[model samples]
Target: MILPEIKREGERYFLSSFKLPDKLTFAGQPIPLDNWQVRERIEYEFYQFLEDQGESIILAKRTGRCFPPAEKQLADAGLPDDLKYMLLVESKCVAAAYSKAKASGPWQFIPSTGRRYRLKSDAVRDDRRNLEMSTEAAVKYLRYLKDFEQNDWFMAMASYNAGEERVRRLLKDQNITDYWKMHGPRETMRYVPRIIAAKEIYSQPEKYLGLSKKDLYMPMETETVTVNVKDSKRALASIAEEFGTYFLELKMLNPEFKKDVLPRGTYQMKVPRQTCPSRCFKQDKTP
Candidate 1:
């Protein structure tokens, strides 16, 4: 059988010649793999796995869309770079994303968990889904779990996903502390690998992944804008229009605001770095 030739180009390596894998079968079912479908499926899954391995790099490139501030906050909080990918895996960096179980945000904190972490969830606001607040809360909880698990990030991460109590029980029952050696649900098994994948991709973007420089969105610089606009969505739209930009740009900048409204009291707004210096105000200065 003729094998595909692997060639290196600049920082990236490609398989010049290759053979498609034999059709996979499970039970009595034969998997379908039409030409275009097979190519799309393989590319999708491959990139997904690549993003999982190198999430930091991938996420940083798409920072504007995915809450780049969270990444900076995590680093400032002294957390591992890999931990940033947890948010990516949980909510795809969308603060408003909600799960069927009521878990929400980048951290995927359930109501109980949010309460435990002192994240407020009321009519005025739901900190559980707030990117900044939830990120801080997640950092605190992860730190607590890390201490309890003896600084085992794997166990701490699993605890974050499955719950501390459950993780503790599993550890006790299995009489094991090594996450790699522990047996649990399939998700748990893939969780660490996913994180690792993201880290790898982020570290060496051009090496393992296929992304163009233009496709990568650089991190935007932003400052807090406290405007007393009851309807955040409308207010953001107004601001975007005032600035001659898109509303989605505003939404991307401020992910914590749930609903279409920014509640009463001062709300934080992030304007692009380019616009920040020109628009940001000091104590006595006006934008």
Candidate 2:
């Protein structure tokens, strides 16, 4: 099988050859590759993702850990499975990703939007940094956009990148509902295609990434538990000790917490299976 041409020069890698397939689809809608402008737009995004192998490879590794849950959420929400790629384009699956716009988490939701979606933020917790919570919010938000865009997934995705009001105004001004024909902000124009680019390259990673199964980063298997912190002054290190885990491991498992000290709340946490006894842990079935 022929692969996308890749060449390494010193420390950098370049994609020397890439061809647009005759057909491509995003969120179950067929991409108009026959249109020269659309083809070029797609090519631009392809290069944006593939030209640097380091970022591309890191993204591929992250996809393994991040995509499955989001994909499942999309499926459950009855949305297109391909919609998960939006997260990849939004934050490259970085849980701690924070934008200058203050969009946080792999879903890249700003504080106001995050709160609107029921992703609460407090001194002790930011649900935007919690992968599961943020993904759930993203699914609901996309569903709303999909309905608002009159079931057009492309326009829905565009609305996700650009505000819905702007997309609505663009549709009214341009008198077109077609995402391809309607002109919008430059970044908004590129956003959907970037997501499509991620889908294409990641769907068959070996074609672009040349990575084996072992090369990908797998999600850690852990059991979810409910921990009640009765003392506001108790540090996470103390809690970690109670669970037979180190403070760092505890923090790594629950990235939502903003501080090392507990704030007297009932919190759900994840830990290695068998690390804590059943009496000490309350199994959470919330997924």
lDDT of 1 by residue, 1-287 (tens): 33223234654333322223446322122334445543344444435554343554456566444546566776887866557767766776767889998997778999998998898787656777667788888888878987888877867887787777887887789998766556777676566545544544444456554455666775565656556565523455766555434579777666655555554456656665444445433332343
- My TM-score estimates for the predictions, one after another, are 0.67, 0.89
51-93: candidate 2 lDDT, tens digit per residue: 7778899999888888889879888999889988887888888
Model 2 ranges with Cα > 4 A deviation: 1-14, 275-287
| Predicted structure with the largest TM-score when compared to the true one | 2
How does model 1 score by TM-score?
Answer: 0.67
Where model 1 places Cα greater than 4 Å from the true spot, the runs are 1-48, 51-60, 63-71, 210-215, 229-246, 262-265, 273-287
lDDT of each: 0.62, 0.83
